[model samples]
Target: MNQERFKTLQIRLSGLSNWLITLAVIGILISIGLGWLVKGILILIVVIVITPILLILGVQWWLKRNLIQDKCPVCSQEFPAFNTTQFQCPNCGEPLKVEAGHFSRLTPPGTIDVQAVDVSVQQLED
Candidate 1:
């Protein structure tokens, strides 16, 4: 399968797992309220055991999909770009914008230049 399709599948699976877990928890609660303490405990135990595994797998998939190698435009240094559009280059401290899997330097704001001049005043005699 292509990378994009695989990533999309991973996201969908993660959401499905979350919904399943929610339903399981609700079932456990209902079982306990209905006086099936042992059944509820077993289901709770199963959920507790499975949740961490699903969470770890989901996080691994997300990190792999979101973190990408990118080169800084100013310094040409390569770094991992997380899920963000704007970031600063670590090597040269330049602000950068990410678009279409490419990095570009951001334009700095314009500033007005000011100059100081000294003036001499003549005193008027009455």
Candidate 2:
């Protein structure tokens, strides 16, 4: 998956998870209002128990799907990365950008270049 698609998917997943949690909370509140205290507690327990497991599994699946094994363009150091588009090279510490599953060194900003000139000064004796 490309970076843009991956980012969209990530945002969608975040929204979905938020909706699911909201729904769970509403359900628990409704159960408590109906005097089903035990049921509400049970639902809370289930959510607490299952949410982390589901999140872990989901992240694992995402990693497996988007993991890329490639070499850093500047240092040729091979490493694995998710399809996040930009990251630092572990071995070379160079900022790397990814496109089409290929890595390249990220260039500094254009404004970084500054003109330099030698200065000369004459001092008179005090």
Candidate 3:
């Protein structure tokens, strides 16, 4: 999935996870109020063990999916997002520059256009 969809999924998952924890808390409270001691303990155990695991796994996948992976036009080889800000390519040592993208409200909905701008003449050596 694309980035925006992935972000939306993360948000949704966050909300769902929060809602689940809240429900578990409510269930525990209700069970205790009704004197269902065994039911309350079981619900507490499941919540304490399961909810955090699901949240951690979801966050891990979200982060992995967001890492930038692209082939360099110069070398025709792939590099990880960790090197995006470096001035030169890891393989060919060709000069590179990193720039952040900006959003335009004028653009169409549900799309982002990544355009390269010429900043090669900066005083900083390539």
Candidate 4:
């Protein structure tokens, strides 16, 4: 029975490792395909196609292997680990509680501040 249990455990671990590698490979493939298809799309495809898969795999592996809840305090967003102490809520600006895990690589929001050009000039006396 002990040997059987050990074999089962080994099989489970090997399966998990294989799954993670598959996810990483798929993400890379999708990213490359997107880049080739869209010349100017930038990193949008990565965010849309790859992040969710990685996040899911990370969260699952972390939760199962480590007997702790690695989740964001605010918005209840779940992560693999809480490396960062502070995180801006993805849904809102409210700060979330982070454990000792690294925060997701979030892209900063883009903004445009337009300045008006002044047409008036000072006249000089001749």
Candidate 5:
């Protein structure tokens, strides 16, 4: 288990480094392409302006698709599950939080009588 985890970490680090290098190479290529073409505005625009933006976008795509680890919503720690509500965060014991659902209602009517929060938070009157 420890070896597997170590390998996973190593792979993640390697991927990050690779993406950074790719950005650098794209930058160099853009500069060279601009110098070679010398198409004035178009050259500057395509190589100087567009390539870096594309590099940034590509890095984002790669990280989102390949690298980001799933995190526990409550404790904000990386864990294995893809969805929230699988279990309480093991580290913090807080129930896993989930994104708001469509028309999500906090409490069903008639389930509990909610009094003013300023009042005692004891169980609602039956």
Candidate 6:
């Protein structure tokens, strides 16, 4: 899941970087080479608007991908899961939950295969 999200974010960032680079080149040409003040200002506005948004999204993707953890929706703190169960936020002591659903990719094999045990007894003239 994280891998898929990371890959998607990476592709988006790559495409945004390419566009930013192209716009930057154009801004440079307009500002310094041609001295087109209005066009340069417009391009500068676009740069200022998009750079921080892209940076924030990139950071979010990196944290989600590399941290290998989940963020608590209650306290907004990050935590790890031991099994398919609920937990609390360590930092804020808030009640939180972590449900990975059925057949998660992170779940280990044979974890859910076991069922109730069976017992048998034989008696003779008891």
**Candidate 4 global lDDT:** 0.61
What order do you get sorting by lDDT, best first?
2, 1, 6, 3, 4, 5
**Top lDDT hit:** 2
In angstroms, the error of model 1 at 2 is 70
- Candidate 3 stretches greater than 4 Å from native: 1-37, 82-88, 93-126
Question: What is candidate 6's lDDT per residue for 1-126, written digit by digit as tens?
Answer: 689999989988997998999888877877686657657788999999999999999988866654447666544665575445555567776654445521122234565634567889778895
lDDT, model 5, position 19: 90
Residue 11 local lDDT, model 4: 89
How much lDDT does candidate 2 score? 0.83
Candidate 5: global Cα-lDDT? 0.58
**Model 1, position 74: C-alpha lDDT score:** 64
User: For residues 2-44, could you state the per-residue lDDT of candidate 4 as single tens digits?
Assistant: 8999998998999799899977876786787854535344467
TM-score of each: 0.53, 0.45, 0.33, 0.22, 0.25, 0.30
Candidate 3 C-alpha lDDT tens digits along 16-123? 998899788767878778547657777899999999999999988876765556665566667665323444567876655433421112224686657789876757
Model 2 ranges with Cα > 4 A deviation: 1-35, 93-95, 105-126
lDDT of 1 by residue, 1-126 (tens): 589999999988998999999779767877778547656777999999999999999999999877778898767899988755788898899888877667877775694435669899899999
Q: Cα-based RMSD of the predictions, in order? A: 20.1, 23.0, 23.1, 24.9, 19.6, 20.2
- The TM-score between candidate 4 and the true structure equals 0.22
Residue pairs with backbone overlap in model 4: 82-99, 82-100, 82-101, 83-100, 83-101
Q: Score candidate 6 by TM-score against the native.
A: 0.30
> Which wins on TM-score, candidate 2 or candidate 6?
2
lDDT of 6 at 43: 90
Error of 3 at 122 (Å): 37
- Cα deviation of 82 in candidate 6 (Å)? 16
- TM-score sort, best first: 1, 2, 3, 6, 5, 4
In candidate 3, which residue pairs clash?
A: none
